[model samples]
Target: EDLIAIINQYGGAIPETYGVPVEEIQKGIKSGVRKVNIDTDNRLAITAAIREAAVKDPKNFDPRHFLKPSIKYMKQVCLDRYQQFGTAGQASTIKQIPLDEFAAKYASGELTAVAKKAVTA
Candidate 1:
């Protein structure tokens, strides 16, 4: 649907008016959702950037010309998403458990209950 701004494909294109609201996604993140899939948003940003670059210099046949801005726009979207989800800089807080240590913990039956609880919750 997003690509409708440029081209209409086989299934026909609709307006780019459908999406999960950012506030709703943020609410889910706050309510203990461990992960959020936001691939479409990122793709839209990248596509927009590419389209802008292509339109600005229609004869620019080099792929790099399109890719540079695409990377920048996608990076900004990722950063904004991270901030919105309150996950920015949270990677440093993650404790790295080694594979052997994790295996031992699981073998000792320590992780099974936690895994089951997570699944059922």
Candidate 2:
């Protein structure tokens, strides 16, 4: 609760330099904290999966043997984070712009034309 207290006291004005526990991640999110790093947890999950896969088949020389489990574990972590952040079903909320059109506009300078015109005027 100490971490939550500090965050609440500062109103999340300060960026947390240390890793926040998973149990407290939701608290941070609810408190209006914009970004949270869960790299450590994901790394731990990947490392553990790799170790287990390697040990289970000591004679296996193919990289795919270990990578398969690693991918599964990493994917699970990513999905969990997406759900926790309330972005699991938010794809429709994003503007559906085509990549090629965006690239064309960028290349033609149309994307920033208004800003350029404003600056010159």
| Top lDDT hit | 1
Candidates in order, TM-scores: namely 0.68, 0.58
lDDT of 1: 0.75
Compose the digit string of candidate 1's lDDT tens values, residues 38-95.
7887777677777777777899999999999889877888898898888899898999
Query: Which ranges of candidate 2 are over 4 A from the true structure?
Result: 1-19, 96-121
For each predicted model, how many residue pairs clash, with residues at least 3 apart or on different chains?
A: 0, 0
- State candidate 2's TM-score: 0.58
Q: Model 1: runs farther than 4 Å from truth?
A: 1-14, 96-121
Q: lDDT of all the models against the reference?
A: 0.75, 0.66
Candidate 1: residue 25 Cα off by (Å): 1.6
Ten residues in sequence with the least summed lDDT for candidate 1: 112-121
